[model samples]
Target: MDTQTLIYIFVGGTFALYIGIALWSRAASTKEFYVAGGGVHPVVNGMATAADWMSAASFISMAGLIAFSGYDASVYLMGWTGGYVLLALLLAPYLRKFGQFTVPDFIGTRYYSKTARVVAVICLIFISFTYIAGQMRGVGIVFSRFLDVDITLGVIIGMGIVFIYAVLGGMKGITYTQVAQYCVLIFAYMVPAFFLSFMITGTPIPQIGLGSQVNDGSGMFVLQRLDAVLTDLGFQAYTSGSKSMIDVFCITLALMVGTAGLPHVIVRFFTVPKASDARKSAGWALVFIALLYTTAPAVGAFAMLNFVDDVNETQYSEVDDWFTKWEGYGLTAFQDKNGDGVMQYRPGDAFEGAPDYSGETGPSGERALANTPNPESENEVYVDKDIMVLANPEIANLPPWVIALMAAGGLAAALSTAAGLLLVISSSVSHDLLKSTFAPGISPKQELLAARLAATAAIIVAGYLGIYPPGWVAQVVAFAFGLAAASLFPAIFMGIFSKSMNKEGAIAGMVSGLVFTFVYIAYFKLVAPAANSADNWLLGISPEGIGVIGMVINFAIAIAVSRFTASPPVEIRRLVDSIRVPRGAGDAQGH
Candidate 1:
């Protein structure tokens, strides 16, 4: 079968399985819709959490980012994986013991204030939306390239698939679908890496192959060879650090803590049968995630080597079939400076060559092009990072079947996370907003309808955002982590650890954190955009790292405000005590 047909079959099969599961496990009660009745097995919940946590960013953009950025991109690898450790050790079990349907429910009851609950809901929405935007973009890129559809159409189709499972099954539907997604995505990611590793180093395992000696006549290791070649071409060493120590520390910390704080991820723990199960589930989730995480660096290194070898040294217009082919999809660009047919991919420092069209020239100037206008533009460099994962099979000359698997994997990653995030938004709106605050006397049937309505509305909004994403998938994803770190993490942490934390304190902390992080992001990314070649970011820190600072401010303000407020009532104190115990799970999510 052709690649397109294979892709359609694989993607179609996966969606069919998800829809079938959703239909079979259709939620019948508010509890089932919101928390899957807290009845899923620990291992299954763990797999679901892995799918929830590892979005399209992890499956598609992460390895690609690492591929080009060299050692500077280690932040993603360490930060994202390390967050699961934090979740398992510090948060998941206790939150499950607290037994709430949503994060806002925990905050409202824990702080004994409805206002605190509303604030948490707002933060959850912001984080979830930021996250969903990236997934939408990812789905678009995958469809445009593999399925031969326009990106807009790809996004609409993706939305249709997600809406079917998410609206039909709620948490129950999403959880089962996510488990299936985890398998498809992880297998898709590993197959190419293993094949490429075996081809290059005679080792089937990529992690081991990365550290093994290269078979390319050179006696040096793969890492050493990659470093040597890239440096000779003016790129940084593959294994050595390029970013400042402080920037690395901040970005890594932000992602680590931010991962633990993400509502979509944390909510998965609520579906497990017991508090102990939540703790065990987190451990399994980390194991599933680490399978891909450990292999990612190897994939990154291999893809980088393939990229430099394929495009940089070769003539752009006269290069291999792949170059012209991808250009058809708008990913590779070529411009002939000085009207020369040969494309030069080198450092921009040389004045003799044409103006640098590389993104490094900053955003102010138009892209540099050679004398030719249409057929032979001046400076053409086209390699979208999103293509890195999907194109890896082709780069390595793997079997067509392997390539088909990757297409399925990309769709799985996008759809699984979309379902998880949609569930969080739906539950927060229907269960927390409508039933809890707006109408406490709401019936289970009414609440279920409300949840379905909220889910439908959220799906529409998600579709809109996916159809018209504002930024690159990876960078937009970073904003979601930032918002989670600054606003939700601190508030939830304080609400649990500090009994005296009041409504004013919680609101103040959340507002301060949210506003500070948002303004900092807007300042760097959109507002008052920088003018220099060097990014004029504060302290060389990107907006993604500003969350650590914002989180600190949230913690400080909440602590100060709590000291001045009256202590919690005896009943509230008793409630806090009850939540800390696994046996009190029923009372934790009080009726």
Candidate 2:
């Protein structure tokens, strides 16, 4: 069968399966809607958690970022994985012990204040919306390329699919569907890696292929060859870091803490039966997640090597169909800057901004650009970093079925996380803002209806953001992580570990951290794009890394303010002490 036929089969089959699961597992009550009745087995929950954690950012964008940025992008791998460890070991079990449906639920009860709950809901909504924007964009990218649909229409299609499963089944439906998505995404990710590895290095294992010498007569290792090729093109060496040490450290720390504070991931723990099960599920999730994370660096290196080898200095008329297809979507473009038919992929911007196509063709039959070419640069190609992974299979000339599977995997990664984020938004609005605070007298049925309505509204907003993304998939996601680290991580960490952290302190700290981080990011990214360089950044810390400073400020201010304020009530302090005590330990101590 043709590639498009295979894509339809794979994507349509998966969508059918997801919708089927939603129907089979539809929630009948508020408990089922919120926590899947809190009876999920550890292993099942682990697979679901793995799927929920590995969003489009992980499956599609992380490898792409690694491909373009080389060693500097290692921060994402370390920060995200390390953050998972912090969440599993430090936060998941305790939050599960607290037995709350959402993060806001925990904060409200733990702090003994409805105001604290509202503050947490605000933070959750901000982080979730920012994060979901990336997932929705991923969906659009996949559909635009594979299904031959406009990006806007693609986003609407994705929004419709998510609405069916998420609104109908809620957490119960999302959990089981994620388990299936985890299987599909992991299989799809590894298959292409195996093919490319063997084709390039005569090794089936991508991890081994990364270190192996090239299959060609050249004896250089993969990294060594990549460094040479990139430097020859006036780009930085692949093995070296261009970012300052402080920025790297700060970005890594922000991502780590941010993962721990993410409300969607935290709520996954609530679906399990008990605190111990939460820890077990976390361990299982790490094992499943490692399958993809370990393969990402190898995939990135291989994809970059293939792309440069195939496209650089190639004649524009003879370029492959994939390049033209992506160009039609306004993602990849080539310009005849030197009036030569040969394309040059070099360092520096190819155009003043993203290519503004003239809706006409050049003499060389390449897409005509309306944007001004960069005079200082000889580059003639514009490649979006988000396209590298999805285009990798095509660049390497892998099988058509493999390409189809990749399309399905990309959608799976994106939709799973989108569902999880939407659920968090819905739960926050219905459970935290309405049921717990404003409309405390509402019945269970009313709350369920409100939850579905909130999810519907959130999907529409998510679709809009997806259609008009602020940045690349991974960049947008990084901003979300930074915001979560600045606002919520400190509050949750202090609420669990410090008995004296009162509502006033937590709320004040969250507001301060969130505001500082948001302003710094906005100033650099939106207000002054020309001044986004390291020279103008505060302490040489980029907007991406400023969350570390905001987090520090949150901790310091919370501690200082708490010292001056009244301590928590005796009951709240005892509740904190009880959560810290292990389940069997209390019984043993009594004996």
Candidate 3:
């Protein structure tokens, strides 16, 4: 069968499976809608959690970005993986023991204030929405390329699928659907890695392949060869990072804490039956996540090597079918700057057009009658980095079915996270904002209706953001993580660990931390980003790393305020001590 037919069949089959799952798992109550009745098996919930947490960035974009950026991308691997450890250690068990419907629920009750609950809701909304845009955008990018549709159409198709399943079954639907998605996405991701790895390095394990010598009989390790290739082209080494060490540390720390604090991730534990299960499930979630994380670096390295080997300094007319096809999509552009009818891939002002070479010294220097020099001039062919992974299969001449699987996998990753975020938004709007605070007397039936409506609306907005994408999708998503770390993680941690913390202190810390982090990101990443350089940042922290400082600020302010304030209420103090004591804590009052 042709590639287009294969994609349609594969994508259609996965959508059918998800819709069937949604229909079969209709949620009947608010509890079911929000937390899958808080009775899911730990391993199943862990798989669902992995699907929900990975997002489009991990499945589609991260490896592609890593392919081009090289070793600097390790920050994502280390930071994201480490955060789950924090979750398993500091946050998941306590929150699951608390057994509320949402993050804001714990915050509201723990702080004994409607204001705190509302603040938590605001932060959750911002973080979830920001992250969902990236997911939706990922859906768009995948569909746009594979199906030959406009990005807007792709986002709409994804939104339609999500609207059906998410609005129908809520968390119950999302959880089961994510289980299926996890399976599909992981298989799809690994197949490419396996094929590409063995093709180049005679190793099926990507992590090993990254360290193994190339099949080209070069004694150098794959990374060593990759680094040589990169440096030869004036780019930084692939194995040795180019970013400043401090920025790397701060970004990694921020991601770890942010992962721990992310409301969508934390709320997944609420679906499980026990505090112990929550902790165990977090470990399993990492197992599921690590499958992709470990393979990504190898995929990235192999993809780059394949890409450069194929097109570097080759004649434009003689480039492979993949090159020609990608070029038609505007993803690959060629300009024959010093037109000799051959390709010149390097960094210059002159394009691939048949330009005069008689008097020109070229963008860097005169064209050689000798072997092709890696030019300092602008590359004749410009390839979009984002297209790297999606195009990898075709570039490597993999079987057409594998290309179809990539499409299905990309959709699976995107839709799973989209459903998870919509649940967070729906739960916040229905349970926290409306039912709990504004309409306390609302019927369960009415609240369920409200949840579905809110989900529908959130999906619509998410779809819109996917289409227009507001330009800061990556930064905004990253900023959401920073805000989670800086604004929420400390409060959540201290709520369990500190017995003497009062509502006054927790509230003050959270608010101050939020403002501090959000404003810094806005200033550097969004507001006056021209001032985002290292010299302008405090302690030379990049906008990406500023959240580490913001987190410290929260810890400092919370402790200082607690020292001067009255201790927690007698009941709240008892509650803290109760949570700390694990005896008989298994099912402690499931909300």
State which candidate has the highest lDDT. Answer: 2
Off by over 4 Å in 3: 347-377, 584-591
Query: On residues 134-252, what C-alpha lDDT tens digit does candidate 3 reach at each position?
Result: 78877887887788898789989999999988999899999999999999999999998999999999998998998899988878888889888878976667777767889999999
**Superposed Cα deviation of residue 279, candidate 1 (Å):** 0.5
lDDT of 2 by residue, 1-591 (tens): 999999999999999999999999999999899999999999999999999999998999889889988998899999999999999999999999999899999999988999888988988998899889878978988998999888889999999999999999999999999999999999999999999999999999999999999988789999998999999999989999988999999999998998889999999999999999999999999999999999999999999999888889999899998899888876788888988899999987687654221111222221224367878878898877778889988998899999999999999999999999999999999999999999999999999999999999999999988887544333344568778899899999998999999988988898899889988987866667568789999999988889999999889888888889989999999999988988678789884
Alpha-carbon shift of residue 4 in model 1 (angstroms): 2.2
Q: Which stretches of candidate 2 lie over 4 Å from their true place?
A: 355-370, 469-476
lDDT of each: 0.79, 0.89, 0.84
Q: Which TM-score value belongs to model 3?
A: 0.92
Error of 3 at 167 (Å): 0.7
Model 1 residue-pair collision total: 9
Better of 1 and 2 by lDDT: 2
Ranking by lDDT: 2, 3, 1
Clashing residue pairs for model 2:
none
Which prediction has the highest TM-score against the true structure?
2
Worst 10 residues of 1 by lDDT: 358-367
